[model samples]
Target: MTDVVAFLPGNGHVDARLSFAREKAQRLDVGFELRSVDYGAADSFEALLDSVLEQTSGADLAYATGIGGLVYLALRARGALTDQRAILQGPVLWGLETRTFPKLMRLPLMPRALTLAIARGPIQRRFMRKHFTRPLTPEFQRVFFDGYRDARAFERWFAWLTPRLLRDLEQQLRGRPELLDGLTAWWGGEDHVVGIEELRRTEAALGQPISVREFPSWGHYPMIDEPADWTAEVARALAAPH
Candidate 1:
């Protein structure tokens, strides 16, 4: 069976948020796979980048969110996804003007202690609850807490998000605008995490209009807020012609 591959965010958790893609794959009778690299294990950022490139090497249809979306853009810009379809949800390509989390994580060793503190059970729950619309499910919360127990997960994600890397990705996409033809962007109208400005920067960098689907009432976690609706939308996108 063909696969509907999803590249997960930095935490690398196969959490409840991915069920939308899994259900859509089932409706299409395709396999579902969650892809993630251990940023914590990589010796250097280049190694992590290479792993991400390899993880997303080839796919008929792919789903990526946040940092994963950035990885997808890098691959697309490099001509690695010429004929594949990509569903990018809340891609953080730019728009860091107001966000302090990414900026703080990129700091020196001081952030390690901070990341570990945030990884603690209570803090993680509070942070996640803020982003989600509804209460967290037991299953979802279990995996989420388990996934971030290792502080390095958070540490390496920021390590990979250096300004130099972001600049290089923007330059590549701008230089080869044709490479992004197969991308479809999904955004929650109320999403504050990767808000409208980030989406605009993505379009500006690619130099082409992106196909976008906006969810009026949803925040950053549409799958957690309205799983069935998001799953149906995924099905529609997969069934639609490329």
Candidate 2:
């Protein structure tokens, strides 16, 4: 059987990382494909889930990062997880329920455009500076800006930011801990976005044992910071038998 590696990128310009994913698949002597959710076209969370599921169909292994992790959880909830083998890199699977801003943004009184405006402004860079351990590389920064040229996409993503989604996902995983089976999670010890502590909390909340890979020196975006090492590890995983 021909093996394939499907990459589900997070919200942002993922051209470079997508290329790296292809290289990793090549190292495993497998075909490669990218299945990023069309945040712009999806009008509802259901639509977003469908987009991810459709894109990931027929893959031997699926790798998701950031928001992509949420998509996978949603799939598991619906009993439609396409790939039997999957990896989550710094997934935002928890903690949204406790975040006030995302909750406020979803309230009827809040203007949806406000979130998009903030995304396009300096606040995002400020957030990155505060949360990430190091400055974004020039290549990563260029794509970050390029992604904003499409305002509609950001608006769609903002619409799905709600505490209810996180709560529901957590509940689903808690109810069926087996949903997490066959999944391996990767984290950068230095990644402030989803730190080691949050990972622990997620593990506790789910009460499921998740396979983990910790890289002490890496940060949030290992593809930008340590492409060679990151790809090497992913290649090894792809080559290993299930």
TM-score of each: 0.81, 0.78
The backbone clash count of each candidate, in order, is: 0, 0
Q: How does candidate 2 score on lDDT? A: 0.67
Which tens-of-lDDT digit does each residue in 1-242 have in candidate 2? 55566677665544554555456546654433444444456778787778778877777778777766767777877777633788899887666556454456566635455546545547667766765555666565556655654434444554675656767777767767667667898988878677666567777777776788898888877765665677667767777787
Q: Assess each prediction's global lDDT (C-alpha) against the native.
A: 0.67, 0.67
Best-matching candidate per TM-score: 1
Best by lDDT: 1
Q: Which regions in candidate 2 have their CA more than 4 angstroms from the true location?
A: 16-37, 100-140
Clashing pairs in 2: none
- Once fitted onto the true fold, the runs of candidate 1 whose alpha carbons sit more than 4 angstroms away are 10-40, 120-122, 151-153
